[model samples]
Target chain A: MAKSIESLIPLSETAYYILLSLNVPRHGYGIIKYVEKLTGSRIKLGSGTVYTTLGKMSKVKVISVYQDRDRKTVYELTVEGSKLLELEINRIKIVYKDTLYQEGLFNEQK
Target chain B: MSKNKFRPFWSYDVLKTQDWLNDLSFKGYKLIKVNPVLRIFQFNKSESENKKHIINYDKGLDGYPIYIKDGNDYTEICYTKNFYFLEQISDEPNSVPSYNDLVSRNRKIKYIVGQMLLFQIMLYSFFILIVIIFTLGIGSVTVESIPSNEVEYTTIEIMSAIAFILVNFGYFIIQIWMIYSFFRLRVSNRKLEVFCGDGIDMSFTIPKDTILTKEEIRKLRKEKKLIKKTKVAWFYSPDKIEDWLEQMELKGFNLIRMSKIGNSFYFKTGLPRNVKYHVDFQTKKGANYFSLNKESGWKLYFTSYSRFMAISVWGQEYTELVPKYYSDHETKVKHAKKYMWTYLAVFLPAILFVVLSIGMSITLFAYANFENISTWMILSPLIMLVLVVELLFFCFKVIRYYSRVKATEL
Candidate 1:
């Protein structure tokens, strides 16, 4: 299961934002608004994209979705999902470090 | 003074009916009451300004609030069953009452069409049976069979037969009119879906160079150039049907169309390609359902008649990973269980009836003399027993499918 979780590491921008927004349980509409706000109104997700992505993530055990008291579908990331997100964040951090080193070398040569 | 008018099949197009009612209101006749069963519209003369009448149909609106303030724009005048009659209070054209959910309103239309289709089929079949019986009764009698003293009675019998035929003929004409209305309603419903921004643009134009004349098309059809084939099959479970459809597509049979009732599949022979199929069932579906699925590139293949407990078949050709509709384990299990329970609910009562009749027949056979019964009397229960066994087998398969779905909870 961990190895399979490793395979899910390069998540799409939409999926990553969706997972990030689901740190606290939120419905589809809430996730859309939260992601928009998080991205400073840059990444506005369509209901269709959010819906399909959530369905796929749920299928792969990355997230759990259920209906709340108002019968609105709410999504939350699972433990496996948290691990996947952590791995992705670490990969991004390493990429950022490598880019900083490359920029420093270019600056010295200039 | 009050005026009454019989407007049959007006509910087929609620918008048009609303417009007609508003027109009447403009002419001083305001709609007072409606007799849905008799298709009567009761109107009373009114000297007041023209009022906008809105006819709204929603099954969920039954027994709800009859009068809603709606920001003082419109108020519900009356409600019967699922139909709500509302009048615009502001008398402003733009301020007329409108449904917030057009998809559900259209769903009600689809439900009515489905029910009307079923009723039409049953009525036509029964009428045909009656006609056959009447013709047979008449054909079996000869002119000599009637005595001269009973000639008056024969005339009365012929007159009554004519009256029966005339009454049935009138009813059949009304049924035909209802069918026309249903067709129009369906067309309008498709337009509504597009209006709601949920319908996929399926309009494609034939290139000028590739256009064929009628004669050429007929010749091509005669030469079997069109490789379209239709196959008839029925399955109770969605999962089983989805797998079968996917397998068919894999085998180079690309499903192009489905029959109205959804039992027949029309496919065009093509190269084997990977395609994912999803059979979605929803008791109540909104426009969002279609728009969401359509946005993901799933082509709508077929949708069952009624929107209430409707089943839709969707497919998408994919080159890489197989697409999943209900990706989560819980949703997948729940869907399977829904199919199982629906089939069980429908077939259980039928199975019980067959079993009880068989039991009664067996008990009678054991007590009474067996020689008195005809061959058909004995054979009928045997056939029913076979049907009961087949239905039980089907129920078992559906239950097994549900359990299998539940077992994959990882």
Candidate 2:
């Protein structure tokens, strides 16, 4: 049976970034660096948050340890994670469409 | 060369210790090492400037720097059973803050302070129980009652009595001090408010959006005239405290005095200028921690076991400084969570102690039917009674403090 993405509708900012960064296989430090750079230094991942989040996502089959390099465990998103990410992105786009036409926002850019 | 000095600062005031260590550095004494348990820090004589020490805590760290991942080099100094203390030295004009994020830093500090409180309660009760047992067992056995044939018995009893007295006396002092620190933290957390009027005032708020020149600021200060106000407050939340103190200073109240055990601040009205406060939570620190902070512009004005509140006034260009305390939310939450772990650590030992004490009571009750109750055996039940009372008292304190700690969690 295909799992519905309804339960994962409201992903936390941390979880969302972790999943996005996991588009490529990366270890703990690698994921942290990727997230920081991806957000242009707006987001920084703590080791504790990364460790606990990976443990939780692994339990849900969203992410798994892809390989171990230099005694450091590397993690990658699974099929379930990719599906959830796609669904979340679509939901965000729907919200963006509803709000982009509002009075003051996006008017200056146009 | 000035001789090195050491002071015991174990209240988890990481920022204040850093400032103190920096002050020593400026005075020609350089901090070299720290011992957490002994609460002793070693220093060396050096003529260094623009030096600051950064301290970080992590539970499962093994010689790894959690923050300060830039060009700055760091060294692991000392650690307790479940924490690591790492230090970094910087000579740059403005040393980058170790913790730039406030939310995560608050969580980590709450966890550490919570755990420390729990451990303190356990230790206090254990000491109380020991004192009661020893006092009951051999405190008053008379030396005059010794028979001619049993001189050795008298000698043994006297020696045991002396040992019990010395141990209990030592533990009693530490237990009292620790309990006082706990109450101060708890009481301060509940009663913290901003005062601006004749009595304790809570409605005062700092005025914003006013850009005054140096002369205007001085004239305003002269008209208001400096007034001293003292208030007991808990700074369990680092993120809010910095803002609160900053606002107080913005209104011309400069913090001048802080109580050693209680969380009370003495604020004197001063010139309204650009000033900010940074609160850091650390375990005991040595001289080196202070030297690092002194080299920076921060002045260590307040201290508590879990709070190191410092104040600084730089120009508008440097007013947006972040605190260099805990680096991340994980570290912050880890310490607050330790508060719960402390209870877990005590659960088994506490259960065993209660069960054994109950069994001893039952045995003593049954033995009362056989013969004259042994004077020594009678003290066993007294010991049990003290343990139970101490446990009940500790539970009440834990409940009172746990609520305050939970309220401060981000």
> Which candidate tops TM-score?
1
Question: Distance from true position, residue B323, model 1, in Å?
Answer: 2.6
DockQ of 1: 0.04
Considering summed lDDT, which 10 consecutive residues are worst modelled in model 2 chain B? B193-202
Off by over 4 Å in 1: A1-110, B1-51, B55-234, B247-253, B259-272, B283-289, B306-309
Give me the TM-scores of chain B across the candidates. Answer: 0.56, 0.32
Model 1: which docking level applies?
Answer: incorrect
Residue B168 in model 2: shift from native, Å? 48
TM-score of 2: 0.34
Residue B133 in model 1: lDDT: 90
Residues A10-74 of candidate 2: C-alpha lDDT, one tens digit per residue:
77778888899987677666777789899997876644355556655755657654222232235
